[model samples]
Target: MSRAEANTNSPKRERIKRKKQQQGRKDHVEVCALIPVFLVSRARNLLYSHLMNSR
Candidate 1:
């Protein structure tokens, strides 16, 4: 169901909260893509090292 349909039986506050959450998720995805590839690769290497050490 759409946001409007889902908030049909809810109050204005709940609708506003849901709207903000949806917008935040979209913003996060956009920012994630703009991150530098070098930084991303470094992060991946760090995580891989951690995983290897834990195993």
Candidate 2:
């Protein structure tokens, strides 16, 4: 490809990459916030199971 074409494409590629990274970051933050809730629910179920077994 010509140098001019390459230079034009570079900015477009960078913009796309930046958008994807921002989306990924948002997803990660949402998942991170939910992780503790998931773990707590899992632990609660485990405890409940043990209590039921002991009965």
Candidate 3:
């Protein structure tokens, strides 16, 4: 309610916001990294299946 209390809470709120942003960015990076791996593996599996079917 008071300005001093607001000022104290602002820093804590900012820290929490920053932590959440960092975590979101970290998750985004992990998902981005995994997508290519998943695509490669999926492509490999499809290719293997096609080759087996052709044989």
Candidate 4:
């Protein structure tokens, strides 16, 4: 309601927003890193299955 109250709330909101953005970026980076690992594992599994089936 008051300007002083709004000012105090703004800083806290900004901090929360910044923290959320940082967390989202961190998660995105982790997911990006994991994607290659996941793909590699999936490829290995597929290759193993193919080899076994061919034999």
Model 4 / residue 36 / CA error / Å: 0.6
In candidate 1, position 41 carries an lDDT of 96
Off by over 4 Å in 2: 1-11
lDDT of 1: 0.88
When 1 and 3 are scored with lDDT, the better candidate is: 3
RMSD, one per candidate, in order = 10.9, 2.8, 1.5, 1.8
lDDT of each: 0.88, 0.99, 0.99, 0.99
Q: Write the per-residue lDDT of candidate 2 for residues 1-55, one digit (tens) a residue.
A: 6999999999999999999999999999999999999999999999999999999
Q: Tens digits of per-residue lDDT for model 4 on 1-55?
A: 6999998999999999999999999999999999999999999999999999999
**For residue 37, what is the lDDT in candidate 2?**
96
Clashes of 3: 0
- Candidate 3 per-residue lDDT over residues 1-55, each given as its tens digit: 6999999999999999999999999999999999999999999999999999999
TM-score of 1: 0.44
TM per candidate: 0.44, 0.58, 0.84, 0.78
Ranking of all predicted structures according to TM-score, beginning with the best and ending with the worst = 3, 4, 2, 1
List residue ranges in candidate 3 displaced over 4 A: none
